[model samples]
Target: MQSTYTEGLNPEQKKAVLHHDGPLLILAGAGSGKTRVLTHRIAHLVEEKGVAPWQILAITFTNKAAKEMRDRLERMVGARVHDMWVSTFHASCVRMLRSHIEKLGMGYHSNFVIFDSADQQTVVKSCVKELRLSDANFPPRGVLSVISNAKNEMLTSDRFQSLNAADYRLSKIADIYTRYQRILVQSNALDFDDILMLTVQLFEKHPDVLTSYQDKFRYILVDEYQDTNNVQYLLVSQLAKRYRNICVVGDDDQSIYKFRGADIRNILDFEKDFKDAVVIKLEENYRSTQHILEAANQVIKNNRGRKGKTLFTQKTSENKVTLLAAGDEHEEARMVAEHILWLKSTTDYAFKDFTILYRTNAQSRVFEDVFLRQAVPYRIYGGLRFYERKEIKDIMAYLRLV
Candidate 1:
């Protein structure tokens, strides 16, 4: 078949685009054309492989990324691409579960709401209030965190009891988890964990349903594949056990979501999971200067147990990294603000060009306060994501109804 993606890409990228055999893992470095490769791969699947749009599943990490991929696919194949599965992990799972909720004893056209951290805390607070637990002794947030952990690991109340240690707090949290799931089910709701776990259960019990979906989807592509949790891994594994035509793209060095139950083992054991997996490294970076890529590569080299590869950029510009030491916290903020102000005033740099990154979202508060005091135009990124927005939730609820 003739190729549609070879028009703009160079020879190396064209090679990656054309190679469509077995389970492919594109180990893309930062600032690499990972999105370009993914979109081109989808286009190649349709145009070259003759795969229908409904037979493709493109899983992304964030709603923004999913939206971008959907937009790109739409541009590639126009309106026909809208029928394909392209969304975040949670969003896609929710859609899948909602379609076959009856197999898992869940009601169809039900209100299966997904609660974020704050929403879960609210539920926990209500549970604590009903249980008459002391807030001083047992914080709702702490209880919710424990419950969330258990759910992320796909542990049921019975399983939790079997493995429950002698810790009174853990026991109490398990009891709360059982109660929480019961409440969620009664309210016709399912949190993020329930989405995948329920779908897996449905697939296991209902053979015909599973076969129908398995026959429908011919190719599955997952982005940020290293960040898949246990439930997500299980869901993908079950779906691909029949066809085994799955392609996962990710960088092992950039797997930074362990705290939220993301198992890096998924990436490490890709060969064991999928026999004779084809590993392709896209080491040619398109973003950033050569010097910046060197610094990033050096910093990431400190991380051990990674699929080793050196990233190089074709751009020859030299961008040097700057280090500053300040005596106090306030002084550090003041220094950064002054530096940004100086850059904005002297150079053609705009206020939007500069960003302050920190380890935790809490660290952004001091900089935000300092920037406000200095009357600088800056935006702090934190809190609920775009998919967690009220409008998006409402729209999803409506779609779930339909």
Candidate 2:
């Protein structure tokens, strides 16, 4: 019998969705309908495999992605989607900590406040001042970043101190980390990194709590597996250790969050970590032309230590790949602006059809200047999003405090 969720999936995608047991790695290429397969698999587990909706957990990197997955599953299998657990790592940890954190006896309560980046900086600055440290020598932001990295690596302050005891600067940073954590506990607060760190600690300290969750989530699926940090990998590993029914979907080439402590090895070493794991590759391209896929495949092939897959598409296009080089940012921006104008004038393209991408937000200044001079209308997608604005965050902080 054909299920509604499996209607349009290709053979590889169907195989991924119907794989009922064991650890599975889906090397989903770009535009390979990974989200569709993920949602359909969850739907299949409930409707076809006789698994209860509440027994499934689907984790992603962003709350936005979690919401989109939930919405899709809701449409596919109705209101029972509410019974399933679908959330980002941080969010999932937050939920678990709220219920079981007090049991750890770490002086943290269920009502502990979650400190945002700005709040974290404020607390770190206070710790620096209280510790009689020079702000110029030990900047609060840099210190906070080091502490965040330590937490991502699942290192306690004592462990970090012992590991870097020879380095004077690192020793002082460890002191700051210790004091910063003290202040957080005194204020009944937890920083963003603490969410995952504490959960791992909780699981390690309390086997019963870990067992409860490990038994609850019979089937676990992690999206963007390549972007998972050490702490996140630990969290998922602990939960899925018993059942071993974990499915991870990601492209090693898309692992771009290294700066944020994302470990590409998490995906690359999946097969080594899980014995007899089913490996599936989804390399069909649905969003790009043949030329674009070929070009991208060639470029990514040069990347060492990646699971190999070639992306191909049935769709052909007359357009070919174009490479542009400029001596400087000004020239590059000017060239892009001129190309956009030419395309608009010669072809049926509009200013809205032209998009410019840069490595960093700071790099957009030159392009914006060139576009303004050329009278081209453009909009920047990212720049202090509404919730991230100072005033809005301040208001939210006040509400959280209250």
Alpha-carbon RMSD of each model: 7.8, 5.9
lDDT tens digits, residue span 263-381, model 1 = 99898888888877888888888877888888888998888788888889788865587778999778888999999999999999998898887787656656766888899976546
In terms of lDDT, the poorest run of 10 residues in model 2 is 380-389
Taking the tens digit of each residue's C-alpha lDDT, what string does model 2 give over 1-402? 466677888889988998999999999999999999999999999999899999999999888999999999999889999999999998889999999999889799999999888898898888889988899998888999899999999999999999999999999999999988988998899998999999999999999999999999999999999999999999999999999999999999999999989999999999989978999999998999999999999999999988999999888999999999999999998988899889999999888887777788878767877877899888879784444569878998999999
Q: Which has the greatest TM-score? A: 2
Candidate 1: give the clashing pairs. Answer: none
- lDDT by candidate, in order shown: 0.80, 0.92
Per-candidate TM-scores read 0.87, 0.94
For model 1, the stretches where C-alpha displacement exceeds 4 angstroms are 106-119, 341-346, 350-352, 368-377, 381-402
In candidate 2, stretches whose alpha carbon ends up further than 4 angstroms from where it belongs are 384-402
Model 1, clash count? 0
